[model samples]
Target: MFAKLKQRWQDTRTIMKLSLDAEQRALREGQQHPGAEHYTLAALDLPDGSARRVFARIGADPEAYRAALANRHTAALSAIGLAAANANVTPAGASSAADGLAPPAEPTLLFDAQPSGQTLMQSLPELQRRLPAPLCGAHVLLAAAAMAHSAAGRAFKAIDIDLQALGSAAEAELRAAIPS
Candidate 1:
């Protein structure tokens, strides 16, 4: 039981480290408030007596993990873009959307929390809108942290599933069956 717990702790830390790297990239690229890489925060679970080491010690099958991360990162960015795009879309039959509705407000992006629980420096307009409403006022700043973690989890799981089904042809077969 202790061994299982230890492995879980290690896994969580690995994921966190990867997410941190991604966030840094966003910042370096001039993302004033780089959005969270993951949509959920993972709770660490270090086991009692577990050996301590620098967070960088964990690995994710290197090649497979990187490819998978790339795939998910692309998808996540696409999703965020899509969400941004949707903001531009007229609320459908709601002509008021053209000039009203606050123009969807630029999503102020920023992590909701930090590794040390410190509040983020600032929030981006784009990221600020997608946040959970209830969390906005009190936890808006912390939203990025939670979202970053969630995004990482989602990206990793989604990419792993896609890689697993590669070349299966099941998607093509399904598409062929659909009516144009």
Candidate 2:
């Protein structure tokens, strides 16, 4: 049973590598955890896919999206009298104490134990039930959009992007990408 479970997990990892990579990148960049924004960013970074095409159709450049996200984060932090520069000051998994240095001058963003990757992973079984396999970029986009209350969703709304329409377009792209 353990072996079977391990195999299943590995298969899932293979299908979700891009999304997972995004989550890792977010952590490395000093995000407390990955969120819908991270997922979307990852999808955009794919070499070629539905997510990229969708952004292109909307005249949204990946760099511009990243800048917007950073600006939003900075604005939110500034409103609370916190500095955005400190948000990503420390590398992921590195502790100041471990380096014999004093603790950070400011408190870091507090995050729940459950990261966005877990949330995305939890959504996958349902997605697998509804969508065909070899989960592609479009699948990640749809999943991210489903997280309507996530930071990415709010950011999209602020920018006048339509999540529902984006999801529909992703689904169509996924269908087109698959061999009939």
Candidate 3:
């Protein structure tokens, strides 16, 4: 049974590698943006309908999808703050839209956990550390599993998968996704 499971895992990894390879080839030969492809693939890998919606919108206009997702997260966080207030949790320095007040200057600093003048500023090196090596190595494997789960197929979501004519778009997406 253990051997079977290991073989299954290996097979999944192989499938993910093939999918990524195909996507990359399509991007290179078809003149598609790699970031768009990455996000499109990422959407397929996700297990939620919300991600499907975001990816669908992204396929139409990448910028619009990015903004919509950001706005949704912001609204969710704001709602959490309001709920905490109702529970008498005394959320620190959180403001609601109803306040009709200007944005606080120190909000960013507070969120970043920076210290004041009296306290020595310390860096959390761990925060800057890349994801685990094993996790990174298993990327293709995860992608394969997602594909096998039928997440990568058209049945999952509708996306424009046109691959043709190489352009600067793929390079731009690669630059955006991979930090220099």
Candidate 4:
């Protein structure tokens, strides 16, 4: 009898694992903290493939997403004449995101935490309360979809992605992931 009940509540392992993976992804991108883009990148690599399918359904080459993400950051940084080909962007006197530094006096872009990134991370606690327990890759996809005006969004648009379709696919993926 409890087996049926147990199945209804998913464990937090998925979220925890995803979090670690997101952080690792951020580190690989030379960021001190995981941001929305890193989370989405990690989610696309989830073993379940739920997020991957959602993206593929909308014609994204899932495998190329990592490179695309990196390229977005590269393009953004390069636009300002920074040598951004190599993603190791930490510079001396740069404020670590962990310190909650105020925006730079000069126009600057923290590609790591794109303008929309904090909002995406901030939404997690509330999303946890509203979404099913043990949020999965699909949930990450949903969070990303919410950031439609972000760098990741711009990257997708450059590739001719249909944002509306992406949002719909994210919803469908999440619903399918929940146990009935």
Candidate 5:
């Protein structure tokens, strides 16, 4: 029982770390809440780089997906008559009705975990069951990719990446990392 509790505590800590990382991405993108997209970015930036390898293995460009995410945010702001002043490129020239958004918000270092974070937290047990053990970036991304209606899914669609291919690649990465 104590061992089980200890493992759960470790898992919780891991999830919290991922959430903090995702939240940083959200705040940097001027996103109100950290969702699957932010999580996807965080996963790609994970020190292990496991998620990134999946993209490379599949002959895909994670950088392009990152750009698409930026575009996604810019388009979102554009749709609301707001443009990101620091956006990489404006798809639509500034409209007379458009207003520029302020630079990315300051970090609060607080926990207001959102759905994608929650999804990652909830998925730990299932992930441990299916993958080797001790969750990593690949697991976080796999969860985001599995979300049928998430921003990550949309970004993949925008980048022309097949979701099944991504998921399969991520799974293979995890399995490959397991000690022989």
Candidate 6:
């Protein structure tokens, strides 16, 4: 029983680490608070994982998705007459790459701002209840999809991807991956 508890504790720690990584990415991008979109970006950064498989099954490239997300934010800023290039964003730490899953070289200091109305934090409990022992990138993606009104959802819509179908496929894959 103690071993089981230890394993659970380790899993929780891993999840928190990943969450922080996502938050750091958002902070580097000039976001005061990390949201579903940042979570999705971090999930895509996973070197090899279920999240990438889900993207493959849905015929979406994670790299392209990341670029599109950046473009979307840029366009939004442009619409507001703000120059995206001049945005006061910090460069990533040495350990954090533009397109890699490495952890930041130094700890990132994030603001105390809350996430947007639609964020993975709101859906994580339900997702954890549905998934197996260790939650992973795929779980994050699933949760993001569940929040259809989220920034990630809007991004998916903008790219003409049917989120419902993607979510259904991800669910099936997750179920299949679980051992009876």
Best by lDDT: 5
lDDT of each: 0.32, 0.61, 0.30, 0.62, 0.70, 0.66
Candidate 3 residues 1-180, lDDT tens each?
A: 986577557545533443343334223222222222233333334333223333343354434433333343345457767433332221122234423432222122122211210010111111113221111212222222233222222212223322210112322232333323
Better of 1 and 6 by lDDT: 6
lDDT of 4 at 176: 66
Q: Encode model 2's per-residue lDDT on 1-180: one tens digit a residue.
A: 986577567545644555555555455545545666766777776655667876666655656666667777778778999775573443322223323433323223332323555676567667755765445566777787777687666766666778887677767776666534
TM-score of each: 0.26, 0.68, 0.20, 0.69, 0.76, 0.78
Q: Write the per-residue lDDT of candidate 1 for residues 1-180, one digit (tens) a residue.
A: 986577557544543453453343333322333333321112111121111111112322323433444455445557767432333432111222344433323433334333323322234223324321211111222332233344433443544423223212222222332324
Ranking by TM-score: 6, 5, 4, 2, 1, 3
Task: Give, for candidate 5, the lowest lDDT window spanning 10 residues.
Answer: 90-99
Candidate with the greatest TM-score versus the true structure = 6
TM-score-better candidate, 2 vs 4: 4
lDDT: worst 10-residue window of model 6: 90-99
TM-score of 1: 0.26
Note the residue pairs that clash in candidate 5.
Answer: none
Q: For residues 4-106, what per-residue lDDT tens digits would candidate 4 score against the true structure?
A: 4563344345655666656655554455666677677767777878888888777788646655665677676788888763434532112244324322222
Model 5 global lDDT (CA atoms, 0 to 1): 0.70
Model 4 TM-score is 0.69
Q: Which stretches of model 3 miss by more than 4 angstroms?
A: 1-11, 14-41, 44-59, 82-180
| Clash number by candidate, in order | 26, 0, 2, 0, 0, 0
Better of 1 and 5 by lDDT: 5
How far is 50's C-alpha from truth in model 3 (Å)?
19
In angstroms, give how far residue 179 of model 4 lies from its true place.
1.8
lDDT of 1: 0.32
The pairs that clash in candidate 4 are: none
**lDDT ranking of the models:** 5, 6, 4, 2, 1, 3
